[model samples]
Target: MNFVCDRVAVTDAVGIVQKAVASRSTLPVLEGILIKASEGRVVLTGNDLEIGIECVIAADVSAPGKVVVNSNLFGTAVRKMTGDTITVKMLPNNAVSIKCGNSEIKLNGINAEEFPEIPKFETEFDIVLSQREFKSLIRHTIFAVGTNEAKLILTGCLLEASGNNVNMVAVDGFRLALKKVVTEESSVSGYFGDVSLVIPAKTLRELNNIIVDRDDKIIIKCSQKNVRFEFDNVVFTSRLLEGDFIEYKKIIPTEFKTKITADLKSLIEAVDRASIIITNEINKSPLIMKISGGEIRILCETGAGAVDEVVPVEMTGADIEIGFNNKYLLEALKAAEGDRVNLDFIGPINPCLITPYEGDDFKFIVLPVRLRTDVSMDV
Candidate 1:
């Protein structure tokens, strides 16, 4: 394999594909990046069985061949190289030579045939949406994906489609986040009705980094077992979780006993301040919210200190007090959009539901933490 490519362009492409390179694997091939040189371009691919990322960049290819090299060594070497162009050549015995300006390095390479083949989908169904919209869908709900491996299904976010409307939902055991958007157009052709998929959070996070906030369209192709995302000379594919996702509709509360409307930024600031006292002792300190008299008072007591804060709000239904894990409440509030947000409470013990004050585009539910008897709520 012999290829000469722009230093910056190849470095960026290498970084992009390296996200899928296995950090720790028994098979050495899984930790290597495959480089394929063709007529006028070079393709780099990294796959770790669960997810695979491929990037193509323009290059001058003197010889058409392929080689696999350690992703970590190649990425670091390419990034640190000094010059406008980089030349790569595969020598005898699978040894690879890399040269950029005055720097030169010979990296041991694996035969390209050893790399695992990325699955090719037969394109059963597909959906189209702008990169901005797709990124928003992932960022809005990815925080709520469960980390517990026992319930493997909860580790991924659910993507459900009906007509042109799409809903992305993520739920941990303690909280749930839902984002709704309308696609430019909808396609669920191979299926009888709606199409649902559970996509792993790790894959979505990497994809979010790859897709920029642009109006350019992105194509999502789905098959029986794998899903592929094609955008900007890059293809990202991942296997869908096999089990059924939780029934999210049943989990969201329909009726509420209390409703409070507050400025989103102000509420976040208040909670953030309350969290400071218990930042080191999160398990022992619970942020307390006392809702009454058209005002929401925040209180927290911990081994370090205590915090008493007040933020005005518009309230109706009934006055209530609730306790919550500081981190969970803050994360939901940070993810919420719009200048103001509405909080609907079923009671002090039930989950607190949060939504935008104006639109029904998003909903977040955070379960309340049970306050310990020793902690006093004085505000």
Candidate 2:
């Protein structure tokens, strides 16, 4: 392919498409990027046989052609070029020449025929969401996705769209994170009666990186086997994990023995300070949160040292003392988007629930570490 394009535009498109480039693969062609020049545009595509991204950059195409070049080489060359515009020309024997300003480089590229084509889905989307809302949902719950791949289904977030709302749920056995948002936008097709899919956490995270603004709209459509997300000049698609996600809704507690609203920043700071004495992960100590006397005290003690700090809070219902993984508490606090957080507890043994102060925007259920009975272990 022969084309001349603005450097910024080409670089941006390259960066977006290269996100899907295979770092290590058995197939050599899959490690490269497919460049197709036609109809006044150059389409850059990268695929690892699972997730694929295609980005288009407008170019002055003198000849309609295609080539597969090393993603790393092409991206590095384009990034280093100081010229405002770049020209790419395909040569005999699959050799490609690139030039910009005083810089000239030649790269041996693979035959475009070897590049695998990304599977296609329907052109129309089933549902649309505000980019801001979609991104927020992913951030609020993506962290809890299970790390163990044996349970393939738990490695992805469960995306559910029903009625007037869209919900995202992720679980890692230790904790469950759920984020829900209401949208008034209607699907063009009346097909999505109830749609649920397990989308890989990596896919959702990469999708989040591509989205630039809240004003931009994201078009979402899914088939039995794959899910597609389209927005801006980018198209992202991923294969769905086949299995039923855990029935998380049924496990959330209905009532609580102790419920309290605490300043989010204060609690987070206290938790951070209390974790200082957790010397090692092998024998890490848990932080004890004692709620009473109009304050919550976070205490952590190990053979190395101890940390104790009190943060003022407002409590209702009853007094309670709960032990928790300091790391889990900090993660939930970091995910919380509001100034105040509401904590609901059934008992020391039951999981603790954290929510945004007012609305149902976010819900986090964290399993507690059993409190110690020995005097040396108890705070």
Candidate 3:
């Protein structure tokens, strides 16, 4: 392949496609990036079986051809070269030469025929969402996804589309985060039919990073086994998990014994400071929250020391005490937007629910740690 391209355009395309390159794989071709020059554009592709990314950039093509080169080496060379224009030419015997300014580098290229075929988005069940809104939704819920391989479905975030609304949910068994937003255009007729699908968290995160322009719109296409995201000049594809997602509504509580409303920033800071002490302990120390009489107190103790912070709250119903993992509380609080947060507690054993003051669209559920009173144990 022979093509001349600007440095900025090539760099951006290389960086995006590199996300799909496998760090360690049994097949050597999986580690390299496929470069195809055709018509008036150059396409860069990377894949690791589960996920694939392809980016196309405008290039002045002299010959139409394709080749595979080591991704790391090519990316490094292109980034360090000082010039506005870069020229790549394919030579005989599977070799490619890249020239820029006064420097030239020769890289061993593999036959493009050996590269795996990346899936294409053939069916059309498209949805349009602003880049900023979709990116924000992923940031709010992707953190709660489970990393344990045993729960394969939990490792992905659930995406459900209906009417003009879209919702993303992630759960790690201990905590759950749900983010919902209304799209400008409604193309949900075929996207979800009537239910949600589990999408791998890693794929959503990759999409978030690559989508840099806020005003741009993203086209999402879903099929029975895979989903595709197209934006700007890149295409992202991932295989969906093959299992039934948990009926999350059943686990959410319907009633609460106590409800406390407090500033989101204050609560987050209090839990963050408490986590410092709780995290130092050999055993996972639980942070205890006691709410009563217009005040909420947070406490944490460990081998090093203890910390207690009290914040005023608007309380209703009776007093309640709940223990939870400090890290989970911190993450949930961070996801919450707006000035005030509502904490709904159901007895001492049931999970606590956290939501923004006037929003039922976003909800967070956290499982409570078994208190010392429930089971006698040494501390």
The top-ranked prediction according to lDDT is 1
Q: Which ten residues in a row have the lowest lDDT in candidate 3?
A: 187-196
- TM-score, candidate 3, is 0.95
**Residue 207 error, candidate 3, Å:** 1.5
TM values, all candidates? 0.94, 0.95, 0.95
RMSD of each: 2.8, 2.4, 2.1
Ranking by lDDT: 1, 2, 3
1-379 in candidate 1: lDDT tens per residue?
A: 8999998998899889999999878999999999999999999999998899999999999999998999999999999998999999999977899999888999999999999989997987777778988899998999999999999999999998777888899999999999998876774456667888899999999999889999888888998689999999899999988788999999899999999999999999999999898857525678999999999999999888999999999999998888999889999999999999999999878999999999899999999986664235432
Off by over 4 Å in 3: 189-195, 280-282, 376-379
Query: How far off is residue 206 in model 1, in Å?
Result: 1.2
How many clashing pairs per prediction, in order?
A: 0, 0, 0
Whose TM-score is higher: candidate 1's or candidate 2's? 2
Clashing pairs in 2: none
Weakest ten-residue segment in model 2 by summed lDDT: 185-194
Q: Which candidate model has the greater lDDT, 1 or 3? A: 1
For residue 308, model 1's alpha carbon misses the true position, in angstroms, by 0.7
In Å, residue 354's CA in model 1 sits off its true spot by 0.4
